[model samples]
Each structure stands twice: as structure tokens, then as C-alpha cells.
Target: MMAGPRPNALSWLGLSAVLVAVDQWSKWLAVSRLEYGNPVPFIDGFWNWTLVHNYGAAFSFLSSAGGWQRWFFTALAIVISTGLVVWLARTPRSDWRSALPFALIIAGAIGNVIDRIRYGYVVDFVDWYVGTWHWPAFNVADSAIVVGAALLVVLSFKSPDTTGKGG
Candidate 1:
């Protein structure tokens, strides 16, 4: 039997919750402490805490799309998060490799969703730079999503069967 749902499923969900909490907390800290358009250097050459808002999908795609993209992205995130939770619930408890990435993705989706619902934009603060060149500012949720996507890429090469568990 499936034993209903494994204990580790809850554990994985718990970890996802932690990621969401941390992501939200870090965003809160940035919002409270950082001044908009001003970069606070965290590392001399490479990193800075800079506050910005993303109203679009990754890399600000559709950010310029009037105003509906916020709702579009929010709905998309909810759908994806629901799907990930279902997958996480079905996965075997011992399957850390698969569960880890799905959990991260869920956390990230929800984190951004909260932002969309609350402020209509995601609060991003991490700024990476090289002298005059700069990467777009991003936040913890963005980091989680990227890490999860990267893990999925790595796992895909390691094994063709990468889906977590059930429907």
C-alpha cells in the first residue's frame, strides 16, 4: 500500500514552507531596510542589496504588458504549485533526489504568488554586478526557482525518469 502518504512527504512540504518563510522574510527585510534605486553593497565587487519590483515573468518578460500579467502569473503559479504538491504527495519517501526539487519549485511559486496578491509585483533585492555590467535584481523566490530548475536539468541528465511519484 501507499501508506496513505509518507511522513517524508510532510517533511518535504515542511521544507518547502521553510523556503517560503525564508524567502518572504528576506523580502520583508529588504523592503524595510533598503532604499529604492539605491544599491547597498554586500560584497565590494560582486553583490549588492537593491530593491526592485518585477511585474512580469522571468527576466521581466511581459513586464511591460499593460497590467494583466500580474494576474496571469499569479494564476499560473497557483496551478503549478498545486501540481507540484500532488507530485510530492505521491513520491516515495526515500526519493530525496526527486522530492527536493519539486518542493523548492512549489515554495518559489507560492512565494511569488503571495507577492503578486499583496503588492502586484515581486519584491526583488539581490543585485549582482561586474564593474559597469549588472545582472537583473532578484529575490529569494527567484533564487529558489532557479536552483530548482537547475536541479531538474541536472537530474534529467542523470535519469530519464524524473517525475516525483504519482499523478
Candidate 2:
């Protein structure tokens, strides 16, 4: 096996930086260009740009719990981000399956944390619906988080062994 520092590694966190920048830029654009509580259809029957603020986690789980969820989520994101940093540092560059998901998670968690700190809530804009069954509005950060989680699930199934060896 070839040795001496794996090539094109993610330890530098370049992709994480890009994801975070793109997420924050998109959110900024949404806030600047879109009207709150208004649904601007991007597709006839699939998607739309509906701006909304979420005060809690996925699907606004604790959105109704006064305003304390803000700090709670912020702290949680920080902790998660810290863990991701450690994972990224320890992860081998060749482990794209793990590294990509970890970077994505870091981008998403930190992106949402920024919103929580700046506005006390997350700025959600992407909206999808089918007839009256509408999905909750979410932003790029949410998308990254979901995709990263899905990728992690797929990786788990792809390699049933928990050990990072014997491939």
C-alpha cells in the first residue's frame, strides 16, 4: 500500500469551508431577496422558495418552547462541530466515505449555529409540497445535514464492520 500522508485529504477542511460559505451566502440571498411568509414557486407542482424562521430542530420539533431552544441548539451545534473537527483530524484521507459526511455535517451544524447566534432562529427558505401536504421550509444547511446523514447511513450499510480496517 502506498504510504506517506494520503493525497487530497480533507484534514485541511477546504470543502467544509466551501460548504459553509455557500450555505451562508445562499441564506443571505434568500433573506435579502425573498419576502417572509410568501411562497415563490420555483416549480409548478414540486418546489418553491418560501421564507420562514425555525426556532427548533428538524420540523420545528421544539419550536414552540418559548425561546430557550435557541441557546440550547447553539450549544449543541458547537459541541457537534467540535466532535467533527476531531473526527476529521483523525480520519485517514483515503476514507472519503467518512470524511465527506463528517465535513458536510460540520458545515451544516456551524451554518445553522451562525443563524441561531445572529437571529435567534434558523432561516429556512426551500419549500416542497404535494397538494396540501407541505414539507417544512429549510435552507442549504438543513439539506447538507440530511444528505450527510443519509450518506452516513449508506456507508454504515456498505461496511457492516465497525472497525476502520480489513477493507
Highest-TM-score candidate: 1
For all candidates in order, the CA lDDT equals 0.87, 0.87
TM-scores of the candidates in the order shown: 0.89, 0.88
lDDT of 2 by residue, 1-167 (tens): 78676454456478888888999999999999999999999996989998899999999989999999999999998998898888777776767888888888888999999999999999999999999889998888898889988999888778533575645
What TM value does model 2 have?
Answer: 0.88
What is the number of residue pairs that collide in model 1?
0
Q: Candidate 2, overall lDDT?
A: 0.87
How far is each candidate from the true structure, as Cα RMSD in Å?
4.2, 3.9
